[model samples]
Target chain A: AGDAEAGKGKIGLCVACHGTDGKGIMPMYPNLNGQNATYLESALKAYRDGNRTGGTAPIMAPMAANLSDQDIADIAAYYSQL
Target chain B: AGDAEAGKGKIGLCVACHGTDGKGIMPMYPNLNGQNATYLESALKAYRDGNRTGGTAPIMAPMAANLSDQDIADIAAYYSQL
Candidate 1:
């Protein structure tokens, strides 16, 4: 797990669709709160590396591209805590 | 719009993740029941054409590749009705 404090600041990109609470704004977006951090990190990494290939990847892939390994761990840590 | 009766036969590929009722098998898999028909069709098309690139596309894209426009519409109609 990475620092939750560091992740809080970088989560703005996620709040628009996944929500500030990670509950999500639509049925298509899916919830992120309380999800497994390892799963979340892997998913983010997949999107960043062009492995994840779904309709919503365009929006999420760019966001993942902006994160570092530590940032992914931090973001996953923050959401998993919620 | 498509024939709901026709859609019933084409939804098997979706049942593993989305369930027979389109409710989804896991938290990571989103529910598809009662969602907008148009949204479902568009989502499927997006997955088919490789425009919806997301984590789950790998599973869904290949399935969508086998479906026609009518198949998509019918499947969407079936799920939206559920």
Candidate 2:
């Protein structure tokens, strides 16, 4: 759960929107810094599987679709520590 | 968004920890229904101005320092119309 290095590579695309610090670039983006890992995983999966919707969903869907389970886990772990 | 009956009476202490359709009944509590009423009033004024900590921030800093700014904008417009 502490693999920040691996998560960095996997979540590279997210930085454009979520910011490298995970503080979110805008109010519309949502600061993920210090968010719970379990919650992050659930939300990401929801976005991937079409359970959640928003202006960001279209962009997120494709990005989430390409991630493996491990990738998702690692990213969540990394963001939790941010 | 629309107001949900004065945010169900000023959130009523957030339903003992977010429930009744806002989702989060557990897992560290964080559903907030549909969310996004200016990001739930910027995360409840960043947990009532302490800059957002975990463990529920000492019961959400005395319930958001007694909420008055139109009751946090009508409970963030009633949880963004959850």
Candidate 3:
């Protein structure tokens, strides 16, 4: 449902914590490598909408707030595959 | 890899926070509904082994500490399909 190539190009904002390989850079961060695409998409949407909160939500909400559905989908696709 | 029925029987400890429907009862708690099974299993294992830290780790660690791999798998399976 999303273009992974496009997602890869759009990952600049994510790489610092999530890493280029989708593995979290820190212990507190959850790993995204091989995660579920649908789950990722929903999580991103929830973040963008300010529906998901707590833990890293404060950090993630601002980052995800501007993402379009397509952006969320692409990012999800990119990360789900590792 | 896991029996949902078996997992269903093991959810007593999880229901207080996660709910019987796998949806988290509180915003700070993550909803386990339809989450990725592999991710859930790994996360439970991480909590049990004290490899995952920060946020709710202190609370989760003790809860997950005694779970066998089979218990983790069954729980994962149960939550993943919710």
Candidate 4:
């Protein structure tokens, strides 16, 4: 598991869509609060790797493009606990 | 909106992976507890329509293939409330 504090610092890019509390700002976006950390990690990695596509993939791909594995893990940890 | 009682009757195929409680039985699957109903509905529709691909898409596609719009709505409603 990654550090939640570190993840919080990296969530600036995510808050615009997922919100500070991990709830999506729009219906099209899924809420991240209390989601499984493993699932979130995999989803983030999929977005970063260009292995997932559909719906908001176009937007997420770019946002996740620069994330490292540690970044993904941290973000997942933070969101899963929300 | 969908009827939760109706959805419960339709979860026979879902229990193997998502479990009866909407929590995935494995790390590879996502926990559906407390998800947004709209997002869950859209996701189910995407799977049924072949519009989304990646990760568990292959598995989900077949499972969702026979679902009608009402089935999707009811299932989403049931899972979102879990």
Highest TM-score model number? 4
List the candidate 1 regions with Cα displacement exceeding 4 Å.
A1-10, A21-43, A52-56, A69-82, B1-9, B23-43, B51-58, B77-82
DockQ for model 4 equals: 0.59
In candidate 4, what are the lDDT values of residues A1-82, reduced to their tens digit? Answer: 7777899999999999999899888877898987888888878887788866666778899999999999998998899888
What is the C-alpha lDDT profile of model 3 across A1-82, one tens digit per residue? 8788889988889999888888766645666766667667766776787654544667888989888889988998898786
In terms of docking quality, model 3 is incorrect
Residue A73 C-alpha lDDT in model 4: 89
Clashing pairs in 1: A53-B53, A53-B54, A54-B52, A54-B53, A54-B54, A55-B52
Name the better of 2 and 4 by TM-score: 4
In the order shown, the chain A TM-scores of the predictions are: 0.93, 0.89, 0.96, 0.96
lDDT of 3 at A35: 62
**Top of the candidates by lDDT:** 4
Residue by residue across A13-33, what tens digits does model 2's lDDT show?
Answer: 798988778866665566676
lDDT for A11 in candidate 2 is: 80
Quality of candidate 2's docking, in CAPRI categories?
incorrect
lDDT at position A8, candidate 4: 95
lDDT values for all models: 0.77, 0.69, 0.78, 0.85
Off by over 4 Å in 4: none
Q: Native-vs-model 4 lDDT?
A: 0.85
Worst lDDT 10-window in candidate 1 chain B: B27-36
What docking grade applies to model 4?
medium
